[model samples]
Target: MNSRFTGRLHLPGEDGYEQARIGRVFNARRPGRRPAAVLEAVCEQDVVEGVRLAAERGWQVAVRSGGHSWAAWSVRDEALLIDLAGLHELSYDPETEIVTATPSVKGGDELNPYLGRFGRFFNGGHCPSVGIGGFLLQGGQGWNARGWGWAAENITAIDVVTADGELVRADADTNSDLFWAARGAGPGFFGIVTRFHLRTRPLPKHLAHTVHAYPLDLFDEVMTWLHGIHHTVSDLVEIVAVTQTPPGEREAVLLVTGVSMTDTPEQAAQALAPLHANPYADRALFRIEAQPTTLAEQLHNQRTANPEGHRYLVDNAWLTGTAQDVVPAMRKAFTDHPTPQTFTIWFSMAPLRELPDMAFSMQSEIYSATYVVYGDESKDAEYRAWLDEAMADLQPVTAGQYLGDSDFTNRQLRFMGDEQWARLRAIRAERDPKGLFAGYLTADEPPTNTNHWER
Candidate 1:
């Protein structure tokens, strides 16, 4: 690691150094490298002051909240990282169903207590520790996305510390452009978002989730079955397609993890049964097991922490139809499962049916999918090489990656499309003119140039 940093710096020897060096990937991609200095912000003023200091000293700055970006962009080399991870504060009101939280509050249990205080729940990605800033900014297209809209759609307002350190509120009327861009523009684009006001609603009557795993040999049949199910399910059901390498398996497995909010798990499972009764779904595997649990509990199960120090490679794209041609291509690659490594291939078409197309991209709203690869650091070279190769190999079939599972790359352009990309870039040009908070550039960069750093 390079040891040269010019500023009022914080080195490895400092007490606060370790805190800022933490990676967001939990058990993988531990950046291990530390930034030159860690700007600990307690309040909005602290954010303004810290960013102002970084700007004055000409330092490249990255904002840190839950630190869960796939690339660990939060803790990059030579950065005067703004550690907002410590600024935990929240307030939720029953009457208004409006919940306000600091960028670092993590918006799960910290938020559940408040929402539970009112017997209400706000729609968010099930990851308990995922910060509202990154998730919402990236167009949080998951479980509740089809129901409540993306995180950006649910957030009423945001308290942002801009490039030049001015604290301001952005919402529908005042900063409409920023509001639009923030919804799905991916995080760290406009500036450091300090606080957020999320719109909460009542919990559904029943939260039914189940995982159905199928053999790798029947991957094609499974894909077809999934496509058929997605084509028929009602608007309220949320389904996820995870094409991953199961434990002790050489060929990749198709795991359909679904959560339905119908009257009963039986009803939900029955609604999905037609899609499951095919040869692919019946390829000698256990059936979908349903359970009843609170939305908060469901989220906790999804993002539980584990021991650190593995690495990951993930890319995404949304295939609209059944993707008849894509199934076979994946099978050939499935056999060469990289060691200490696994992949998560998911499919969904719920969110598109739920939100207005004019505002955010509907790419993630349909039969969307992601390719995830995970392994220990020892195989970083082998896995990373495979990731790049596989993505290049798979690009002809689909485009448009999901932000929830994407990394920093020029490959991001396909999933969101050109029209939406132009709008987001325009918003970035206007609000964040100096481009201070410019860490998570889409894997697929658009036609324009984004060269100027924090100025």
Candidate 2:
């Protein structure tokens, strides 16, 4: 009903309010807080105006670009939700090797459509429906993270709407600090990002994978062998292990899936050859499957398996030591899953690029997580507690936490390390002097420096 806003706004009990209130992964229906209003911004101007309105009325504003936060931080109680779903748009410059898009743009639905045409692709999240905004901001762990780096490092520039309702550009040569902060700021960002300019890469000619399954009895042996062979594997490959019950199975099984990015089938096979060379492979193997596929095909299966509607309890930790060091915890995480649908993932990430100085500093050798998925509300508390206990057991081997999968309220310096945390707080205080966008991520209080710091 606000004429000044360039987009449609829905208040509580409004006709479209329920539909607009949904977050990507978290169904906002249960224990719903009911935001003060949801503003579906149609363009950058709409976002600019909406921010000004929220500030004028002294209302807390929560920016929602992807709506996929496992914790559902975007739709908070009594806050004004700036929904960017209506702002979906994408553009690419061949000569510049850069792709620019509105915050609401998704990797599978919006990006791949155009990227496939140009024979170019950006390293984005594995999920098709994930929005580019939060994915990149939270240090995107894309398909081949080892070969490329965090998706945030590929971001060349960002157009941010600051707390003062002014649009500004943050990049390397200009507003450097803001650029550095925005790349890995997660949900703690002090401004609303309207657009992202990212550097693109040539799409690999072939994407293929080989999978192996082993019974829980072989978990330790298989895990030790896999970790021991890490150095022999190529950066073009990724090996992930999960524990879940297969179709027609009553017991949980440990499945190892390995993917490779290469120019040809032969190259892909060669890159993954080390996996099959394990001397003890035959003793632990239960099944094997291999295939060559496109990114779209892979994402399709992922979406089908983990569809929207299910309740999820997600948490992750970065392993400081090798997989062998965390074998006991990993075994327990998978074997004792709360439900048949629940899964625990171990990501073998070997960085090929020099780590950048950013807020996303949890760059350990391997990343481990438990994804507890179910539909029954009655079992929510039970599943959450299980995940908490699993993570607690893993704490000894963990170097830090991943902000994207972490509980914002409980996040500590371990996620970004103490130095980065201090710097983030200082910048947050200077930029958001009024603490306008506080508690969107970690609840750490910003510094008291109201004085604007110069670059």
Candidate 3:
């Protein structure tokens, strides 16, 4: 095993073993689950050999790309952890307008910067540091997802190492079952995806934004208005409403923001005009209307909102219902936060686009997620309880949950449609009958793929 791997391997109690295990994890709150051994694979062959080696030793395989899973799903007990941090392959084809990137590639920080050179862009995760592997697998809700659709929709192909230790390419035609599952299987995928072939769009020439900040006291009134009219806004604009304490501010404020992707200032202004006509603009603490912005500036703001090295507990729901029902149910999540850095977002996917036939068949017109960020280790339970209460408030209107922000060990919600979930299980049964892959880190024997309350 040592001879085949160009990268280093860390065994239990070995020097640097602990660092190799969780060094790349984004959340400060580490899990107690530990792998039997950690293999830091450097190349494609290393991944292949590592899987073969795991099979020979009868160890289940767990893969990590970018290590940014909020739940730290990569670290599993008695598994061979194949860390894909060293796989940094990236290239772009001018003719096809497709960018091929390794799974570990950071979507915002690395892939976008590289694509920007070619005047192209692939909508990736909002957090600059999130790796495309987990993000894309869980149905990436990237920037302008409301417009461009889920990031997985842009995936043209993926090179995967199957549970049987064969490296194969999965796309719309060949190995299509794997292709269908890869887009939305999340941590339950049966193979290690080495590379992603993604379709890219011509980078927008101008970026303009509109931001309206309202006092938290008006959360209901302001949110009700937004829910009623967001779908009427142009598709080129990404809209979101969030409540968080801004830098240098002691109290949290509700910020309704719209970012328009257009070629020229005139186009941007026109696309963002509807948002500027906000009824409560006069009551706003501040307003930035149709102001020019850059992707660099937008990414910087995302970094600020989701800072590193803090213990993060996140939960989300695909929401459905009228403003009258949804707005009131969201009051606790939007207004009462446990910490200053904690935030809850109301993302608009109104007039939701139809999803392609894939395993990720669950969504609603509204997406709500609460990120509880804090530093005190002793307060994990306290903060968790608070987050549970906040999310409970939304259950009256909650449809399901997105896997990206979910921790199934704490709570499990339906992440896929009933039919898609059944199809995914059949594929998993066929591809990995022996269960070589460490699937879905949950507290139960098998994840029910149903909202707990409904059960």
Candidate 4:
């Protein structure tokens, strides 16, 4: 088994076993579960071999692309952890305008930067360090998702190692079931995706933004207005409202922001004008409208907001209701903060776009997520309690949850439409009938894709 691996392998109780286990995990709140062995795959063949080895050893296979999952889904007890950090392959074709990349490729940090050289872009994760694998699999809510659509919609094909240890390509024309399931399966995906072939778009020539900061005391009034008008804003603008203390600030404040993806200042100004028309704009603490910006600058801000080496407790919901009901229900999440770095975001996907037939089928006009950032291990219980209460406040208006920021070990919500969920389970049963893959990490034996309260 050792000779079959081209890359390093670490077994339990070894010198580097612990580091190989969770060294790459972004969340400081690590899991106690441990894999039987960690295989750092240096190439695609290694992934194939790893899966075969797992089957021979009677071990389930768990995979880690960038190790950014908040729940650390890769480190399953007694499973073979295939770490793809070393399989960093990226290339582009001019004729096709498509980029082929490995699962471990960082979306914002590597993929976009490489695409930018060719005057192109692929909507990746907001956090620069997030890997494209889990992000795309979970229905990537990338930049301007309200307009450009979910990033997973751009997947042209995938090279996967199936549970039977066979390497195959999946696309609309071939292995279609696997392709359909890959787009939205997230950690429960039945196969190991080695490479993603993604379609690219021309990079917008001009980028601009609008921002309005207000006191948190006016959360209800400001949020109510936003909820009513966000759907009317042009899809070219990515709208977000958040409450957080700035790097040097002493307290949290509400900030309504919009970034326009357009080719000219005029178009940017026109697209962002609706957000700037806030009735409370006159009372804002500060305002910046149609100011020029860059994608690098935007990604930098995201990196700052979600910094590394910190304990994080994150949760999100797809919200639907009248402004009167939704705004008041979200007050606790948007206004309260247990730590200085704690923040909550109200992301807009208003004027919802219809999704193509795929496994990733659950969303609404409004998306809200809370990130409780702190470094105190001792206060984990305290912060978790606060987050539970905050999310509970949204129960009435919460339609479902996004898999990207969700932790089923803590809470479960409907993440996929009923039909899609049923189809996904059937595919998993047929594809991985022997249970070669370690599926969703949850407290329950099999995840009941129903909201906890409803169940």
Question: lDDT of all the models against the reference?
Answer: 0.62, 0.77, 0.94, 0.95
After superposing candidate 3 on the true structure, give the runs of residues whose Cα lies further than 4 Å from its correct spot. none
How displaced is residue 24 in candidate 1, in Å? 5.7
lDDT of 4: 0.95
lDDT of 3 by residue, 30-82 (tens): 99888989999999999999999999999999999999999999999999999
Could you tell me the lDDT of residue 446 within candidate 4? Answer: 76
Put down candidate 4 lDDT per residue, 71-91, tens digits, no spaces.
Answer: 999999999999999999999
Using Cα atoms with residue i matched to residue i, what is each candidate's TM-score against the true structure?
0.83, 0.93, 0.99, 0.99
lDDT tens per residue, model 2, 1-455:
56877789989997988777773435422436677888989989988988888888787788888887877778777778899988888999999989998877887777867887898888777778888888888799887787778889888999998889889998988877788888777888888999999888888889988778787888888788877776568888877878887656788888887788788988988888887776656865564534797787879866755668888788888886766568876666878888887888888785436668877666777888787878888887787788878877787787777767766543343667667778888898898888677445444643221111211
The stretch of ten residues in a row with the least summed lDDT in candidate 4 is 440-449
Candidates ranked by lDDT? 4, 3, 2, 1
The positional error of residue 53 in candidate 3, measured at the CA in angstroms, is: 1.0
Model 2: CA > 4 A from native: 23-31, 284-290, 322-324, 351-353, 409-413, 441-455
Candidate 3: residue 224 lDDT (0-100): 90
Error of 2 at 293 (Å): 2.3
* Pairwise lDDT winner, candidates 1 and 4: 4
Backbone clashes under 3 angstroms, per model: 19, 1, 0, 0
Worst 10 residues of 2 by lDDT: 446-455
Residue pairs that clash (backbone atoms under 3 angstroms), model 2: 24-67
